[model samples]
Target: MTTLILMVAGGLLGWSAYHKIPEAFAVAIAAAIMVLPVYLVASGEGRTQAEEDPAKEDPAQVLRRRVQAVNQAFTEAVALMDLLRRDLDAQQAAREALLAEAERQQRLLELNEEEAEKIRQILIGETKASIRAGRRRELRFFLAGILLSAALSIPIGIWVNSIS
Candidate 1:
């Protein structure tokens, strides 16, 4: 309907320009005003694709198409979330396994320390007993040597004094 209006205006302006109906300046002004509408209409329509039919003849069909597009988008988003959840679950499992292994290693380390402590205690006890036995033998040997020397020296001193 707007295209028909612009065409009618263009025709009237062409006739006025040809007949010199308004004379020089008036004719030019009328011609310009007449052609302007047609030019604007043509330019606007040229920018978009030509439709086989008017766009809104069936509101229900348009609404259905929009609904389908939205549903497809939602389905794709849900699928992506499911994939992300699976990936997160796999990563969590891996992390838990690593933690369990670390805990097991820590327990093993504790057991090793306990065994080392037992060995250390046994070595300390054996060392203490050996030292005590060695000290007692040394003290007995020292006392026997002192007693033998004293006995020999006393007799020798008495005999020497008597001779003098």
Candidate 2:
């Protein structure tokens, strides 16, 4: 209740006192000063009255504490950023390795295709040789059969002519 009375009195005094200043600016500054504390308390943000007072401890000690807290946060943030950088680098390396492996497999596929072609050519040659060998065997059997028939016929012909 007393705080409210003081704020209103301060605002009215500022509204009347700053004649040389622009009326709008003076009113705005006065209203802002009046409402600032209430806004801070309701939001539960910013330094409280006790923390801002600097009465219980030296001002230098308060400044040092705030600085150390900021420094600690900055250090932790730097470490986190470094870890993220390392993870990104590792991911890039892994992706490159996977791409390299894919290229190697492609080369192997090309080599396999070349090997398959060579095997096909070799099989074709072998099949031709087997066919020629089979033809030669067939020719030999036919010639032997013709010679045996001729020999039997010649002897049989001599006997028939003599008997007639």
Candidate 3:
């Protein structure tokens, strides 16, 4: 309200001052022709809703209010992003810790497998020794058994071949 009045008054005063100077009206007319349409378009058609309603005429106040609202919203958005960044950092740290723990567990599992292999080798050696002891006097018996098995296998194979 007051600002618009002041701006119009200033423009009129400046125009009046130019009119007093020699041939300044020519310059003013030329500038006016160039700028009048732009001002009319920028201000919108005839009377704005705010102009019809005097309570909303304070555009300067509205601009200040909008600026404050935007500033607050921007601050809140920044705070949210900061919190998200911190949470991501914490999550990354936890992931690194978990990875390190998994590596340690894997190392322990590999060590356990090596120990089990050593025990398995010892058991295999023991088993070989026991088998040798148990079969010490059965060498001739085993040889006879092998020869008989071979003779039976040859007869069976010949029978299968004839049938086929």
Candidate 4:
């Protein structure tokens, strides 16, 4: 409450001085007014929370408090480090899993390509066989036509000779 009052009075004084004085003097006066209350409060001249208690802390107590703070900070840092290590391990495992999956997918693609090549070869062989069978059927039809014409003309030629 005292600090608050001091700060408010200092602000009012600085504002009034800034309007009434020259530029350099006003700035100096304002600066002094603003700093004076803080200096008094920090210097323990006025009644403060520390002055009300008036308990002088021993050196050993201060040392123990500092040590406890240091130990707490160290424990927190160790916990953070352990957490980071676990996170890194999890990331590594996930990376390995992804790599394994990628390799499996690559092998599956290779097998599919191989199967497609085999199917293409089988289709090519069937097409060649079908073409050869068509040509053989055409040749047999031509030979049968020739044999039928020959068989009809031989009987006709013998009948003409007998009639003459």
Candidate 5:
């Protein structure tokens, strides 16, 4: 049962490292690290049992094996935790980078809107000035026509009265 627990812990450690490390070589190395202790404990168990009768087994030797197994389990657990931490850190960094990019894009959009508004206001002002100038020119032409007609009528009327 202890050996089974050790194997499960080691497998979990290897799986976590595989996810945290991108390279195949690194993942293999991590798996090897996790597997080595489990292999040692398992092989040691088999060897000790085959070599010695259970009734005659040394108490001290059994105690030592138990200590070693516990130690290996603790080591694998620590490694798995470290890998999880690194993965979380990487995710946080990626999230912060995306947020910064979003902020920059938002600022650019606001600047574009402000510039477009300025251009629109300038066009409106120019159009108004053009309309005012056109109205002034029409008024001048109307006044000039009125004055010319009045001056011509007076001269023609005086000449007609003198003829009668």
Candidate 6:
């Protein structure tokens, strides 16, 4: 309450000080002063709730909470599955881009390989190495991500899907 009152007062002060300026800027500043404190308080309360421990709670309540958590986790897993599919699509696009780049590099090397400017080969070699490393890393990580996601999420979905 004290914070709210102080914020309101600050907004009034800002509006009075800038009232002679553009009305839009004055309103924006005053509105920000009024709104920001409430947003901060609300976000702080949310963090506090998330930080609380569940271990001390009653057994029945704990069990109920566990069920709710599982359900919430399943919902999040479905969302992640969507994200994984999108990521895979992005990975495919990246592979296509790499292929196109490789074709361009091959053409460059073909046209210039015998020339003194074949120093460009060094640059292409570095690019090729980086592309291989990136592809290997992304493929392994992205596939594992999808598999791990499926491992956790598939059964959860099957279990909860019947409820609907």
Candidate 6: give the clashing pairs: none
Top lDDT hit: 5
Worst 10 residues of 1 by lDDT: 43-52
Model 2, position 74: C-alpha lDDT score: 49
Q: Residues 24-88, candidate 5, lDDT per residue (tens digit)?
A: 45545555555565666656644555336656767687668667776876577466646644754
Model 1 deviation from the true structure expressed as Cα RMSD, one decimal place: 27.1
How many backbone clashes can be found in candidate 4? 0
Q: Which of candidates 2 and 5 reaches a greater lDDT?
A: 5
Lowest summed lDDT over 10 consecutive residues: which window, candidate 6? Answer: 42-51
lDDT of 4 by residue, 48-84 (tens): 3533453666557655655665565455444443443
Clashes by residue pair, model 1: none
Question: What digit string (tens of lDDT, one per residue) describes model 6 on residues 1-164?
Answer: 43453445445544554455543454455445544444554344433342356565666875565566555544544444344345446755886999999999998887776664567787898999999999999999999999999999999999899888
> Under the 3 Å rule for N, CA and C atoms, how many clashes does model 3 have?
0
Error of 4 at 107 (Å): 0.4
Residue 77 in model 6: lDDT:
41
Clashes of each: 0, 0, 0, 0, 0, 0
Per-residue lDDT tens digits for candidate 1, residues 1-164, read 33353444445544654675643453345345444544544334433332224473475764565466556545544444344345446755886999999999999999999999999999999999999999999999999889989999999999999999
lDDT of 3 by residue, 1-164 (tens): 22343344345434654566422453344344434434543444455466556476687765564466556544544444344345446755886999999999999999999999999999999999999987975887898899999989999999999999
TM-score per candidate: 0.52, 0.53, 0.44, 0.58, 0.60, 0.27
Return whichever of 1 and 6 wins on TM-score: 1
